[model samples]
Target: MKGDVIFGKKGKLSPMFIGPFEILEKIGTLAYRVALPPMLAGVRNVFHISMMRKYTSNLSNVLNYEPLQLTPNMSYEERPTEILGRQEKKLRNKVIQIVKVKWLNHLEEEATWKTDKDMRTRYSALFDKY
Candidate 1:
């Protein structure tokens, strides 16, 4: 479940599905026991039907959906690619700068707005012109 992509934090850029795993057995009427890879050992094999999707017969789909190469800790890095836009939020006594950041390997729509100060501290090259 943790390895499979979801719609929120990572946005639409995340993969929709991760497998065509073998269904070991049916669980009552709503769930199935799937044989997941060793990488997903920590997760429960039983999943709700809503979480599964019918696979379209496309060789490309299998080739394109590269399973995430995860660390032993089961986490991956998300690095920012570039700054797309910027804005300032004016408070009572200070101005807060924010920038829309495009992430590496992700589309423009997946970009998120973050505080400029934090971005600058982490990725100073993104603000070279300013």
Candidate 2:
């Protein structure tokens, strides 16, 4: 398949992007055209799809993607600490306390182990042996 990609001539293989790049270019021009707003073509979805494809990759769903070190306690900086200390809080808060104690343990989830393990795993500079 890759040989088809590499060795094939410019027009030999199917267009890899299937002309979204052309549409994206048009959207850019339309964004600048305040004189005509509806020329945008109900294209918010198109813009969202383009941005998502640009910023994120299939790697985001893979387990092999490098883990990020997030300070679970200080991680939710937007939330107040009082939320953690609230006694009347439900079991979730108790769970948060346990997570704070274990640092990255906050990511722990049952049934779905991959996300939790990926979050807690200490990633190294070295590549995976696999």
Candidate 3:
């Protein structure tokens, strides 16, 4: 439930905000039934007041903004754009490989360190140059 996220972490550092969404009605004292995009149709739209934030006029404040693109199951794919760096971590006798990945539409500071195996499977093209 990514309710009106402006500046926060999303499974590493994907900043997203989906609002200016209208309040459909007040569900109770602390909750409001807000109108959400059709992509979020499968989930409940009612949110606690704490989840919502006051509106801001400056659009660029939405850091590395990327519009929510939902799939049939109401899930969005977060694609990594590039392999920024790599490292190897030693765990007992085994070595684990990790890569710093820059997600598409995300800023450099938001780039996340992910498992190299995971990146290879999900974004094989990121390694085509290597």
Q: Number of the top candidate by lDDT?
A: 1
Which of the two, 2 or 3, has more lDDT? 3
On TM-score, the leading prediction is 1
| Tens digits of per-residue lDDT for model 2, 1-130 | 5445421234457454321233323345323211213333443434434333342446555554345455765353222111111112237445321112122323323212112223235332111311
CA-RMSD of model 2: 18.0
* TM-score for each candidate, following the candidate numbering: 0.52, 0.14, 0.47
lDDT scores for all predictions?
0.83, 0.31, 0.80
Question: Is candidate 1 or 3 superior in lDDT?
Answer: 1
Candidate 1 structure quality by residue, lDDT tens digits, 79-110: 89888899998999999999999987577899
Q: Please give the lDDT score for candidate 3.
A: 0.80
Rank ordering of all candidates by TM-score, starting from the highest: 1, 3, 2
Q: Which 10-residue window of candidate 1 scores lowest in summed lDDT?
A: 3-12
Candidates ranked by lDDT, best first? 1, 3, 2
Model 3 spans > 4 angstroms off? 1-64, 72-74
